[model samples]
Target: MKRWMQHIMPPGTKCMCIVAIVVHLDFQSRGIGTALVREGTNQADQDEVLCWVQSSEAGRRCFENEGFEEKERLEVDLDKFARGLEGLEERDAERKWGTHVWKYMVKFPRQVD
Candidate 1:
């Protein structure tokens, strides 16, 4: 867990954390992720608990569409972590390595009518 998570959700807080949501490459961009998030959000709403997720760049839009607000962002340098690895140069020649961003997001439970 990250520091911001602790700040937002202290011990014993009534909250739900979405650890991961993965869609197959062939199934991506087809509302699957959004549906998954919606289901989770609906559950949280029913339970009257806060919902949280750590979203990747690819999943940010989906999470946002599902009503998750960006609370914080973490940027990691992939190149730095990959430095001195065997065949890195060859891999870099084929593709570029740069920063990867993770967005910390939260959605409060919606009030029922």
Candidate 2:
């Protein structure tokens, strides 16, 4: 759960640290991932910032359980992405990708003082 600080600074604000947590696949569903996220969030203190991630349904469920909500979404029409492509052209990439999931989601802490 090492957080990589990219030092992205907005106007009149402190730099933010982008957290990229890596939990082992073998340890899935054993609370390891949840624990890692909790520990990572515990590191934040008095910094006006944001944290985001791109995840699956299962991952989204986990984040939701931790009080995350869908703030933004982009419906990528695979047809547009493959409009002029050769192989797999006619196929609707959105349908192929299962309900057109969003690759990025942003979330903030529920507890704010």
Candidate 3:
């Protein structure tokens, strides 16, 4: 099945090509997320750029185990951020779904000299 990241990625960043990972929900706790992360890091091993991802709270441990660091925390004020929008737009989609999204960034830091 087609996933959200499959369509929204910044081009050339799929599977083992780019240094990013986008995991699916149903397959999350079964090591699929870790494998995807490993693939990104494997790519980073050969490429100049580092591997990076934004994961949910539940996925933090898998990423941390694979050597990803928490770069920063992200917060969004849906109501404020969604201001000046018409009814039932992308901004209002979250309200309809009744869940706010939070992301913890995971990055394979560049080696320091």
Rank the models by lDDT, top first: 1, 3, 2
Best by lDDT: 1
Instruction: Count the clashes in each prediction.
Output: 0, 0, 0
Better of 1 and 2 by lDDT: 1
lDDT by residue (tens digit), candidate 3, 1-113: 13434533456653322334556776667888778777667666656454555666666787787887666555555555554444677755755433355454445435544
Worst 10 residues of 1 by lDDT: 85-94
By TM-score, who's the top model here? 1
lDDT of 2: 0.51
User: What are the runs in model 2 whose C-alpha is more than 4 Å off?
Assistant: 1-24, 45-48, 78-99, 109-113
* lDDT by residue (tens digit), candidate 2, 46-97: 3434555655555777666554566555456554554344355445454443
Name the regions of candidate 1 deviating beyond 4 angstroms.
85-96
lDDT per prediction? Answer: 0.86, 0.51, 0.57
> Cα-based RMSD of the predictions, in order?
2.9, 6.6, 9.2
TM-score of each: 0.83, 0.52, 0.49
